[model samples]
Target: MVLKIALIGAGLIGREHAKLISSNPRVQLEAVADISEAGKVLADEYGTRYFFDVREMLDATKPDGVIIALPNAFHAEAAMACIERGIPSLVEKPVADTLEAAMQLTEAVERKGVPVLVGHQRRHSPDIAKARQLMNEGALGRLVAVNAMWLTDKPTNYFDAAWRRQPGGGPLLINLIHDIDCLRFICGEIESVMAFSSNEVRSFEVEDTASISVKFTNGALGTLLMSDTAVSPYNWDTAAGQALYFPHQPENTYVFAGTKASLALPLMDFWRHENENSHWQHPLLRQHITLDGSRAYENQLHHFLDVIEGKAEPIVSVRDGMLTLATILAITKAGKEGRIINVADMLG
Candidate 1:
């Protein structure tokens, strides 16, 4: 059975989600809502219903599932409305602007007993999946440390969208959250975090560069580095050179160091490691696991459809969203305060 979908927000990410949903035979894009006329244009292009208000869309075309891809600040409000109506929803990344908002939305979803999935599409990437599998299978035995880096060349078009420059929508929430959530998926829970950021070289109010360090509950340490000021491309370099097939904007890289072995992957390189008898000469198996065939957005849409069909568990629940958002908020707070912040404290 094809699951009907209602998409909220007509921005780049929302349109990407809509394209994926519409193309899937198991899913149908039924409606779209955005406050801008661009929403109507997208709806017309896709031959789906369009609305200027979310409430009006909900009233007019009641879809089986909704994908909320609005601005970060609008996530909680939009998600709460859908949950109140008992409609399963897939909210885009970061979930909300603040930890308090994330918690409230999570509570609303729990109270309504509706499935709420956050759109952390990295979890659906095939290369990431393999890495996760390897981690689970002890390929990286007793992980020791993880280092992640994502540097991008921000074109003028990035600033073309006024909201992208605002306080709540900078590199941390907009881009780095993917890495943070993916790290959690592979490395385990983060106990505490310290972050430093700067707005240098970018014509925005929010920081364009950020460095974060995490203390995992598993006793593993992690360092995450992100910058939008990178004049030269990084994702593409990783995708082409490392042959790590990432879906879109292929510019992130990761290096995982384990007690038994260590491996470095650019973007989404999912390779196994060969353990040596001696600890000094640990060698990594040079098998490049490519997942360029499937787009993360498409996989995420299918997962949402499965949730609506009652055939699978949500890949990213509202609870997961809360936790990830809380972690990011903690990092950002720490960066601002120049102190380490406990992830547990942000949960409250």
Candidate 2:
């Protein structure tokens, strides 16, 4: 049976969701809600209803599930509407624009016991899921240190939106938040962060580059470098060949070093000595980790279907998304203040 799904927003990602929902046999695009005519056009294309307000769409269409792809600030409001109607929803990443907003929505969902999945779609990628499985199985064996990168170049007009020139719209939240979420997913909770940021290239008040130091609650440490004004394909979106829009560039963007061995992601190369208990002086051997050969977005939609059916739980819940947002916020605060910021303190 095809489940009817509605979408909020008609922007880039909202369009992507429309296409994805249309393509899935298990789901149908029931309606679209946006304040723009684009929403009407998209609904016409998909043979679905259109509404200027998400609440009106929800009340009229009463979809089995909703996908909120609106701007960050509207995420909570849209998802709350879904929860109010006792409908499950997939709220696109960051969960909300502010930590408080996220908590508010999270509290409502928890109280009502209405399932709302936070869209950190990368977590659904085969490689990311495999990494977490490997870590859990002690394949990495006591995570020690890690390194990651997300350097890329965006066209000048990409920042034409005024918000992109401001702090919240920069790569830290716009791009690097994925990396931060992946790190937290693969490694563990981020305890604190210290960073150095600059806006020299774009100089639009938002940082164009940053270097981050991370300390995990589990005692693992990691480093990350990010930029949207640089020319490089060392980011997971490209390197993993899993992202929807980017051309595939096979490379390793993250490396996890542990007491027993080391692992490089997207490449899935596991490195360790010929002997398990060998010292660093010994030569290292390489092995590849096998994956299920699935795509991220598709898997995410399938999982959302499962969540709506009460057959699965959300992998990235709202509270969990808050932690990721808080961690990134900590990095932002750290860079701005020139001091270490604790992730937990950000919630208080």
Return the TM-score for each candidate structure: 0.91, 0.98
- What's the CA RMSD for each of the models? 3.1, 1.1
Candidate 1 residue pairs in clash (backbone atoms < 3 Å): 235-250, 235-251
In order, candidate lDDTs are: 0.80, 0.91
Tens digits of lDDT, candidate 2, 1-348: 899999998988899999899889999999899999999999999988899977888998889999998877788988999999999999998798889898898899899999999999999999999888889999878999999999999998877767778856778988899999999999989999999999888778889999999999999989999999789989999999998888999999999999888999999999998877789788899999888889999999999999999999999999999999999999999999999999989999
**Candidate 2 regions with alpha-carbon error over 4 angstroms:** none
> What is the Å distance of residue 197 in model 2 from its true position?
1.0
lDDT for model 2 comes to: 0.91
83-159: candidate 1 lDDT, tens digit per residue: 87888889888889888888888788777778888988878877677678878988778899999887877777868
**Candidate 1, run of 10 with poorest lDDT:** 236-245
